[model samples]
Target: MKNLILLLVTLLFIAGCTSNKTEFKISNNGVEAQVLQLKNHQISYTVKKDGHVIIDTSLIGIVVNEKSLGSNSKIRLSERFSEEFDYSMFGGKNTAYHKTNISKFEIKEKDGFTWFLEFLVSAEGVAYRYIVPGTGTQDVKGELSSFRFPNNTKVWYFERNNDWKLKSHAGEWLCSDISQMPAISKMGPVQGLTLTCEMPAGGYALVAEAALYNYSGMRLEAIGDNTFKANFAEGEKGFEIEGDILTPWRCILLADDLNSLVNNTLVPSLNPKPDGRLFADMSWIKPGKAAWYWWSGKFSTFEAEKRTVDNAEKLGFEYTMVDEGWERWSNKWETITELCNYAKNKNVGIFLWKHSNQLNFPENGYALMAGFLDSLKQTGAVGVKVDFMNGETKSLIDFDEALLKLAAERKLMVNFHGCQQSSGEYRTYPNEVSREGIRGVELNNMKEGPLSASHNAALPFTRYVTGHADYTPLAFTAPGETTWAHQLATLVCYYSPFQCIAENPEYLLKTQKIQPAINFINEVPSVWDETFVLPQSKIGELAILARRKGNDWYLGVLSAGEKKQLQVNCNFLKEGNYSAEIFSDDILAEPVPLEGLNPRANLTKRNTAIPFKKEVIICDKNNNLMLNIAANGGAVIWFKAREK
Candidate 1:
């Protein structure tokens, strides 16, 4: 009887061991994630950087039509593959993105309905999505994705507002406790589109949605305790898939610093490649500077609009953006057609604005929009800016996709103003060059003192991390609020493909103090060949970004705090001598009127917006350079490699 009892105990112990199961791991470039499939189909994963825990067993799964995917998922045919590919960009950091290391896992589920979950692991981060093979339709009840971080993690929270007009105050990124999730609201207090976490190990991890096609945009719900759940704008059972559907990529970008975070191309790399045929000779899709008119007030007459276009030509701007109210001119069609022709003769293009909701209005809206775009094409209008797309619902997402596809068909470049953050769509449609998702210069117009230097300093590390921001930069403000040099530096600091020079043309030519900066701005390429973020930079305090367009390097340094000195390391430059032009705050210049002076003046002009000092420096194999930036001020440096 004793021998039989011992045998029974041994069998029970074996059963317990089988139930616990061993963990599965996927890793690349010293980053690792261990995944476990728990009881009731729950999927949990913990991310490790260099074998140190960063993400602690985060829950991730989905629910379909009120049924949980975690209820009973049987993994079938698990396979892994890695591929390396390269791509060139018309407008982005570097002309070409080097090889991408894609490690993918394809798993089949088996709990009645047939579906697949594919997880892509890369050196930069992780992304996963669901695929329904040959589907009729699937009603998604909701997603069960949650991010649980270590208690020490902190975040830069952006309280989102569903209403488009309320987006201005959302620009400021406030550092906050990870455990405190803001209350959910359709109006305010929502988390940012990208929730960046400061890791305990001195690294960074960013969470955002990618390839957001046919799905509602994803937001994060802080459920407390260093935990956040993926929340879609769509309610339970709101998302439906039809005919071989693939879901959007839910991604997390991991990096060692703010620079690496800014430099990571993981989001676009995860998107579908742009079909060359869709663009049909993308050579005409020019990415350059535009002179915008709305900020200076409505140019309701052809003559008023003509002066703006003339200023654009004077400043060598490639385009003049004719905003709303242009339709009020007598003989509107003739006036616009004449303006386009005039701009073309002056070697400048035109971008027109249209209200997004107007296109959605009843019977005539869609037809009218289509017809207007066709007319614009005939009128030689190069681009269109669609504004006021207030929400991130599925319907709006669908509408945006449709509009972009149509715009591509018409061979017109597009800019989405007052819209949601970009979801890597530019990878698939090259014509969609820029979008306004941040609270930019337009906010400064509403409240004079709010979009301060600190807000500008934080933008690169925050908003620009997600994608290009149409901040409509270079607006003038009170002398005590932001220095003239800071405004001038922004044109180089911010990355916008269809960059808008927010100042009036008259200001660019008349601002005598900023002309030297203006000359550099005129030639500054909208896209970059390379980018470097200085190590000494701090979020919300200072930012120093250096970018290369061909052999020329543009350095933009901004300080939101007290005056301080910083260094620019040019070790990344080719081993050779170069001539550098420095535009910085004039320590001795007389102060001008701090009020009523147009803030949107062409800053590169001397005495244009704020008085500045310009100097020429020569580098003799010493790449290290230093400068003193004033409080609420900044600097712009142009380095050109000398001919051998």
Candidate 2:
């Protein structure tokens, strides 16, 4: 037994030498704490008894430089703590570059056992204050900041006072006076707070925290010692890209307490099974006949709503979308209920509009709107169009999931707007019918011209690769629109089972030119068995995609701003004759020949070059087939391969 004790002591001595060590000092009647710095970014502490705590206040400095202009434009400072901390930018209004005054920091005692760290940035004149509760020994807190997005300057750039203002590129970390005020919102003040800023040169972010430790019977493990929460105000300005503008507030939170932190800010909550039929059961979504209208203006008046519904049914459109504006003014649950019943009586499913604020219900507001969702179910609404979400924090994430679950339970579908990239959430919650994350055709109606073929071509590779994006396809020759041929090509190039024709039902019937495309749209299913990003022979100028549902294969190719020839191949198919139907440049043609088709066919055996000037084609291997495409155009092909 003595020898065993000696061996255990030896092991303890060796472990002590290898482990990292951190030290802390307590003040303010054994509540406030200060941690000694470590050589590396990581720090560790051990308390001999209960009610001990440690506080960390490490700040990271980021320097941003413009690659195109060879200039260093801004510096961002950030930090994190154990409890909540106060933070603000000091010089947001200053347009002139001031080398002498950049940023200042300070830490001091406030109330019992509590300490305050104040951060002041020069360009924005914003001040941030943090209040950290003091614990005995085991409690932990810290701060960190980093540089991101040096390649693009315009992403975070905003115009101030008609002059281009910038942030400092170099600064030092200092401990100074704590004079910054606590953060406040239009609603009210917040607790457990942190502050962040974006400089002119590129992107930058920071975070901090504070907490308490040494009370009797305060079990650190029971408090879920691994987790912590940080809250910040959501940005109010809308996001602007190139010349287009969109409104959605966004914020980011960082933490060393990985388990304690939940990234819920700005995430959408949508589910697949909405208490009724699965998405696959929506047979009305085939490609043939669909239409869209800006829901708010069109549906606000009874006469207009009756006209839209009657006209849509008369034109034989399978579906119609009620865009934004419906939910903007109607705060009562009865408003939605009435609208839903009216739409149902007209034989059209209503797609209601909702903003992130409506979903959150703002603290105590959830109770007043508690019956809003129940009304949607009672009204027979098909789906809700949700938009303007701009954060990814834990509470928001939880809310997102809750909304999806609630919508599912109520049997209503969902379409998310103002979202980050899709993260396979739709697969889990299939009732999350669609999302808008890419630059789509709406931009053409609002600001810039319609989305270019290049933009459409780039999507299947970058954004669409993530999952479903409602691109609102096929607007034929509206005043500022692309050609009819280009519009037809999008039905195939863009992937969405619940696609929008983006034209009036009356217009569609009058033209009668879009009948074939509408037929195809109605026939296609929303979910696919497989999707492939074909290797493009060219970059930025062209892209091709192939998808399958059941036994049918669909292929789409898009070209941007240029004419080109492509050697189409069937290498992905079996060595057998397949029937194909092609749609290109407003013309629907019969199947054509794809000869010498095999798994190993090379450039020599498969030498057919399809001429394209923004066009699409569909062909079978039994006969030679060719179709012409318009400038800035695309093509869609449906084929049936014989069994091996």
Candidate 3:
């Protein structure tokens, strides 16, 4: 009896050990993920938590292509293989976060490539790992985290650096480092979390995010083994029945280049500006002229339209943009034709606004869309501002490319609104002139003072680093707009080849307070030969940028919320006597000695530091002159140097 009992105990112990062992592996495509019993690879277990089956690996990574469905929903799970690792962090206490045991690992394909590999932990946080083979360079580096929120939720969140802040408007968005969050909105109760980053050459890793969703009563709980899987309700039976409960998900794309980024996001094609085409033939469009538009407001009445166009030309603007609300009948032909003729008679080019779908005629059949493009050409419209294509899906991307092609064919300049951040598209599509991606002058009209200023400063290093942004600079406030100084500095702060100074042209011509900046903007070309972000040490407190437009180089320095000083260097300039025009806030009321202004001073030997909150100093760079800028303000300096 004793021997039999001992044998029974041993058998039970063996069974417990076998049950506790778990095995996880990558699917054949390198993206579909499967969990198997340790002893037998064929014996697979579906993703489950607390005894509830979540997703089956068999159905997780299926690829579906459709126009009606947005790009955010498509899932592709493929293997990512990398040989090296490159990682860096900013604003956090620890900068270098590397992984052990992950010198190499396989990225399992589980419902939409939403799987995480637990790697080494650091003081900063845990580093989740994924591998993308043959799709990366010698080394791989990408952003570490992304944030997701439910629809209709509003929150104020700050990053580690605190240089940027977030005030979201009823949609999903992502923030990196200590930067302000871009406001995003889409039609539908569902909100999405989207992030795009360039991987290092020849190496790739899994992109991961730690998410927190605020629901009324339920406590925050771990829904699945992997955060990516838990956040996304893939193959869940009862998810649709749960009304009003916001389901938040995380998505990461394994991309080899910018093209892959576009392709993975399901954007069919990109609008690329042709190289040096504008330089060859911009005389017809009148380059270096001021422009204005009445946007997001009433401009339908014939009398109102006539007055606005007349006022725009009279105020020294060479062009007028008639934004939305004009397409009341969905027929753009008659309205655009009339507006273009009216603006042409007034000697101002008319920029008409239309939605991308309407302009491209996506739903009306392809041939009919072609006819509409032909009509736009006949209407004599100088340009068209297409808006509301915020998706990165293939159809939307293809539509963007088609619109650019149509515009080019018709000789019409284009401005893209509600766009993802610029990705050097202007390089190929010169006619695709400007894009509204930054938090610019519009925020001043919607929100209060200086928030726009703070966000604008943060953009140069982040969004503008990618390419030109049509920030719609220079709004002169009679009572409630941007400060006069802020308006003056925007020309230098925001970098766009096609800069739109949106305001009542009459107001600008009469006040003439913003002329200096306007003149500077006109003289400067949209394309830059080279660019650099000045090192200020502090993040949001101040930012300095320098860009070259020919033999002449323009440098702009801006401060946000606080007074800061920067040391200027003239090493970037070829040795020569060049004039530097400095613009700043009134320094007289607040006395502070400006530093690093001397690259080279002249017989004008102006130690002359003007004491105004906002001031412009024109100095010759023959003698080193240090530029002193004020808080909540900026300085624009132009220097002409000999070619190296």
Residue-level lDDT tens digits of model 3 in 1-644? 43234224323322332341344433222232333332321122232222222223211111111111111222222334422232211110111222222112223332343222222222111123222222222121111122222122222111211111111111112333212223221221112222222222221112222221211100111111111211222211111112222211122223332222211211101111243554355444333333554532434544456677787666555666667666663455776688778888888777777776655556554555566667766887777777876543334545666676666766777788875444434545657667765455554333232233455455543444335567676654421212344455556656554567655555455543345554554465544555555545133445666666667777766566655555677666655656566555555543322232222111121122323232344334344446555556566676755333
Query: What TM-score would each prediction reach against the true structure?
Result: 0.90, 0.51, 0.55
Candidate 1 residue 220 C-alpha distance from true site, Å: 0.9
Q: What's the CA error at residue 512 for candidate 1, in Å?
A: 1.9
lDDT measured at residue 406 in model 1 versus the true structure, 0 to 100 = 74
lDDT winner, 2 or 3: 3
lDDT of each: 0.71, 0.39, 0.41
> In candidate 2, what are the lDDT values of residues 1-644, reduced to their tens digit?
43234224323332343333343432222223233223332222121111221212322211111011001112112343222122110010101121112122222212112222333222111122232322332211111121121111111111112111111100111111111111111221121212222212322222222111111000000001111122222211111122211111111222112111111111111111123444334342232223566611344543454566666666555455666555554553466566556656766666667766766763563542346677666756677767766433334444555566566656666777764345435534556667665556654443233344655554543344335577776554331223454555566556654565555555555544456555455465444555554555232356665666667776666766654445556555434666676666532332122233211112232232222122233344444344355556566676766555
Model 2, residue 611: what's the lDDT?
A: 23
Q: Which candidate leads the pack in lDDT?
A: 1
Deviation of model 2 at 163, angstroms: 16
